[model samples]
Target: MKPGALTPQDAMARAVAFFEHLEPAHLAALDLIYAPDARFKDPFNEVQGLRAIGAVFEHMFATLDAPHFVVTGRVLQGSTCFLTWDFCFQMRRFKRGQQQVVRGASQLVFDEAGRIALHRDYWDAAEELYEKLPLLGGLMRWLKRRARS
Candidate 1:
């Protein structure tokens, strides 16, 4: 497939489908969604290829409970599809630890095959995640309130 021939709507749909399959542990389907040499970037990891991509998901699933992606909105132009997504899940740093829910969005660029070539996420790590953790949440919230005033 050629990049020029791919429609934005089609690309968006494919991207959504990929996320839909991601829920409830569908590691096997990753190969179908990501290209062999695809590159993925997030706050914590910079990975290349399907194997590395799969490892990212694997780490998430291992650490987080009920991890899922909710597609809130999508915009497509040329080969780039900007997706507003909420990745919500309960995560704990260790067993018997308190769980926290984290949310974020990603802007993705697709190739001719509708596979993601570049995925960049946008969200405030301090506000959305770190601020919500147990001990850190209290300190972060206090800082935020002080800053606002």
Candidate 2:
């Protein structure tokens, strides 16, 4: 290991900090944490490259109000780190006054330069998101009940 090279633990910490303190203005600093051609995937989005990834966040900010992440746990092995977090926000349209929480986990793979090369988030949209909506909530709950029986 080089003396001045960034360590995996360091990179993990940076990623966590970036998320916890993230704001609309911080979007420009994503390059500091992610590789140029990094890939990002979640339930609704699958995108490669920093620009596309940033676009996802931009849309998030535009649609949600006061969105933020709270990391509850983390596990680091080699250059890969897994983080469990709660995404909190208020919907701009439905349930505009109520705060929503979506618990999820993300697997991040860091490059040699200590930048995230890949980020994949895992979460159930039906349970976390769809079930909270006005019209969709009823259908989502019904489906869950039927599946459980």
- Give each model's whole-structure lDDT: 0.76, 0.94
- lDDT for 10 (candidate 2): 97
- What are the models' TM-scores? 0.83, 0.97
User: lDDT by residue for model 2 over 30-125, one digit each (tens)?
Assistant: 899899999999999999999999999999999999999999999999999999999999999877789999999999999988999999999999
Per-prediction count of colliding residue pairs? 0, 0
How far is each candidate from the true structure, as Cα RMSD in Å?
Answer: 3.1, 1.0
State the displacement of the C-alpha of residue 103, model 2, in Å, after optimal TM-score superposition.
Answer: 0.1
lDDT of 2 at 55: 97
Candidate 1 ranges beyond 4 A from true positions: 1-6, 93-101
lDDT of 2 at 51: 97
How high a TM-score does candidate 2 get? 0.97
How displaced is residue 68 in candidate 2, in Å? 0.1
